[model samples]
Target: MHPQDSPSNRPTPVSADTREANRRQDHFGSREAIWLFGYGSLIWKADFAYRARRPALIEGYARRFWQGSHDHRGTPEAPGRVATLIHQPGSRCLGMAYLIGPEVLAPLDLREKNGYLRERVTLHFLDNDLADNDQPDVDDPLDDDGLTTARTAEGLVYIAGDANPAYLGDASDDSIAEQIAHAHGPSGPNSDYLLHLADALHAMGGEDDHVFGLATALRRRMRQAATHPATTD
Candidate 1:
């Protein structure tokens, strides 16, 4: 972690007005089924129940570990790094879209506390096999060649802005990896989160340079630490 990036520097609390605004924009009114985009820990550690899930792609955003975690992954003294979306034109993020019910909103809101706010975005599901089930209507037109074309739909995603106090902004990959290598919080070791995300992406045949790079660095650091234990005179 950066020297000034102390978790004690608590992030500005999410005001009620901001929460209301986010809810007003992303809330599903009376909609039985809602779609949610999951790119980071949500991919493998989705604590909420869902109806179905499909591989999805979202454009105009990039997954980055620029957010500080003070609860699930760290504490008030040493915050752990976590993923947050940053707008980058032409960039696409691959993840999963979950079909969930309306009841999930409350718990999700609490879980994504701190600087994270829910934002609506268009998600393209690659699978065209939703015919067996009642899939939500998509705005994108289908291809005539009978090849499976991506279907587009609006979904809610959690994002933390750079202005947020919890935002770590830019840091060297080695520095970030070093922090993650030794951080642990209420949830568990921060390295577990990185490894899980990397493994999940690999299993889906997806490659995220940032995520994979950090994971590799963290592994190397861990190996070094294990091979040469620190001495205390």
Candidate 2:
């Protein structure tokens, strides 16, 4: 559910008529702050002037290198595939949060459109501090909400169709490594994306030790596979 449309929250829905009338003003309205949870490429290239940004921890959702994409980080001509969140046990992934105003959603909507559906995700967003004129150089940090419960946040969940395969359950580490090696996007290979993610997580001080071993193994496997392809019996 959109923040404006939550059960406890009551925001006047922008009707077709209102939206049409407000089209011109949509870009001109005084922006209200909204928060976005960045997990993948968004960590690096989410475009929006933020009021505050801090390291955050989200629960009940585990990041998986599963869902594939054909856009955003990819193009039609030799398109690249990517991953998304899937339910799992004892999983915690590190990601960033952006305190953006409502005006930014319009662009984000277009960017995350197509096959991706917006779902309400429950994440513990650290009410991080911002650098206002008053709090300049105040050493912004992640705020401890001290509460880990279900909260609604608009998130795009990826679905497969455009040259994508169905969920193959929990793939073995080797299988996932193989996929990353083969997958390619507009920028580069799937392994490159994973490496970038690992780098970003490290940059944000995200806690997840699984990726370390996974990345290291993928590199060695990719190297050996390049020299000796398995003979299909």
Candidate 3:
């Protein structure tokens, strides 16, 4: 659910309303179609139209739950953490990419307006071999003019960098998970967002220690909350 659809106790949003900024920056130029990468909710709940979808990965980045959500997953008083990409050499993050027409950017910009700015990146589409394997082969593909070249494409991704007001920065997994366990907002419980993303990655044969670790921690907190309802209250 979008923040517009519900009553909000949220303060004037802390993050910049990036819809206008994103609209002005024609990152795709005159291209009719462009690839868009989804490493978070867009991976499972694509509320937009797309022509094609593929399992894809980006190099030199690691997904971290450092972005804060004041409108969707939690309130302004107690924001929920969400995933954002951090530059990390030798690291790769698996996600889904969509080939979409330029018109689709309008709604997406609004949905991710909370400090998220559109950034361009190179996407590596997974082949059948990589998809079927128990562990994805994340080695940087050879740059030869063959399969790697054919499977790679330039795309846009929404990123909430530390410069943004809603960036919570780094924290312990348990601390992040604890906040997720208690926070709720227009979209629902924040833990649901964490679990849904984890499930989506597992289905795609993706392995992310960071994501899976938080999921594990969140579940443990949930179980404890269930077992000791009075203590939780």
Instruction: Pick the TM-score winner.
Output: 3
Could you give candidate 1's per-residue lDDT for residues 102-190 as a string of tens digits?
A: 77877877777767788888988877665226444453222232122347777789898987767767777888887777667898988
Model 3 Cα lDDT, one tens digit per residue, 1-233: 43333222224356567888899988667665778999999999899987567789999999999888888898888777788999999999999887777889999998999989999999998865333232312462322313323488889999988888787777788878877776788989899999999999998889999999999999998898789885443
Task: Choose the strongest candidate by lDDT.
Answer: 3
- Greater lDDT among 2 and 3 belongs to 3
lDDT of 2 by residue, 73-92 (tens): 33333223344565556776
CA RMSD, predictions in order: 5.3, 12.0, 7.5
By how many angstroms RMSD does model 2 differ from the true structure?
Answer: 12.0
Off by over 4 Å in 2: 1-31, 72-81, 122-169, 225-233
- Judging by lDDT, tell me the better candidate of 1 and 2: 1
lDDT of candidates 1 onward, in order: 0.76, 0.50, 0.81
